[model samples]
Target: MFVSKLFGGRASDTFITRNSGLISHLIPGDQVLADRGFTITDVLPPGVTLAIPAFTRGCKELPEHEVTRTRRLANVRIHVERAIRRLKGFKILSNIIPGRIQHVDDIVTICAGLCNLQPQLIREEIEGKASDLDEDEHIDEQQEGDEYSWDMAEDIEGNHLF
Candidate 1:
């Protein structure tokens, strides 16, 4: 899914142009979920569906319905974000890659391949204590004047006590 290499200064929308060959794999029935910066819906393949969050255009808050929709979109979008985060975990992609670096493409590809061989960035099912809020429960108990509580512990909101 990695697309073409372009200058870092160029807008991502610029890469969606017909000459960029980035959308060659897209077909009429394809569905594209993209961020707001990708405003190239008109250039998409015919019948393609593009899902993006609503824009506020300077308004302080989006409508409640738009907010809900945006939250849902963000939930799905998190997976893509996590994938990119994992890719960036590799030292090569974590930093600015110089254009003159030797075999830079190969390095990226190898890092991505290595990442794929590892466990998934996220799992569908929750398991054991990882899924439980045991620490929060312990904190709640400690808040009830327990002997184990410190004399000057701050609350979760950072409210300090003398």
Candidate 2:
């Protein structure tokens, strides 16, 4: 899931419309929870449910189709809020960012990857993932097999060996 801050109005709308071309991967029941910022007026791709808040500028009464779309998107939007809270768990992100806005894009991506790598959040699911580990352990395990892997080739403190 990604949230990019594009220019307001048509630019923002265009960015969302184009990027959602990847919606083919999403199956029915899979949902997209977006902020009011991502509220799109047009139809979305099939099988990708969207949950966006009401568009303030539009009339108070939304047509049936619009109401259904907004509700579907809202159900997913709650999860996006949860995700944002989780990301803010890291001090670097929570604190005022120091650099130019241009740098934020890379920082956000790197932070997301790091967050995804963290095991603490997976503690409850780690046991369930044991079977998953076994399936690809030959290629993915570090301490067990894959000594030549990039991860194992470096120290925890990132001291380079080669």
Candidate 3:
């Protein structure tokens, strides 16, 4: 779901508080694909999964498994980034809508709606790449016992050493 409400540059972790209403709508086991900036896992509805890239802290490189997972995530996430780009394409949002502008919120919402109606931002070429990665994911799932995908809080699960 696309959110067009203006949140004036608060930390991404504050997303839970900002979008509290959204939480009630989420069902258990829902998969939320987000970037590393979203660190509000604690506030997520129970059983809701948050998928983000693996962090490479202290280590020179991420594990081979992590690298593959990250690649798969990036393949899906590019579309989200492109959609944001489309929203920002509107001049009002690309530049600052002045405080004096009447109904600025409505204008922003309208722009977002219009942007959504436009064709998918990413071209068809990458669609095949995403599908190919999906097939690889099935193969990986069969090979790896339980490590199906990248989860931001995997470390907190107390299974991974690094």
Tell me the alpha-carbon RMSD of every candidate.
14.3, 14.5, 10.4
Off by over 4 Å in 2: 3-25, 34-43, 51-78, 94-100, 119-162
Error of 2 at 141 (Å): 34
Candidate 1's displacement at residue 67, Å, is 2.3
Ranking by lDDT: 3, 1, 2
TM-score of 2: 0.40
TM-score for each prediction?
A: 0.58, 0.40, 0.64
* Candidate 3 per-residue lDDT over residues 1-162, each given as its tens digit: 345455556535356444746556566655566667776677777877777789898899999878877776665564455555556767776656577366666777787777656654434433333434443542211222222222111111211110
**lDDT by residue (tens digit), candidate 1, 1-162:** 343444445555536444556566565555566667766677777766676778898999899877655555454454455555566767666664577366666777677676566554333232112213232232111112122211121212222211
Q: Considering TM-score, which of the candidate structures 1 and 3 is the better prediction for this target?
A: 3
> 48, model 1: CA deviation in Å?
1.8
Q: What are the lDDT scores of the predictions, listed in order?
A: 0.49, 0.42, 0.53
Prediction 2 global C-alpha lDDT: 0.42
Q: Identify the runs in model 1 with alpha carbons over 4 angstroms from their true place.
A: 1-3, 11-13, 16-20, 57-64, 94-100, 125-162
For residues 1-162, what per-residue lDDT tens digits would candidate 2 score against the true structure?
Answer: 343433445565547565645444445544444556665425545544554456647577877656554554333333334445555666666654575456665666666666445433212333221223322232222231211211111111122111
Error of 2 at 37 (Å): 10
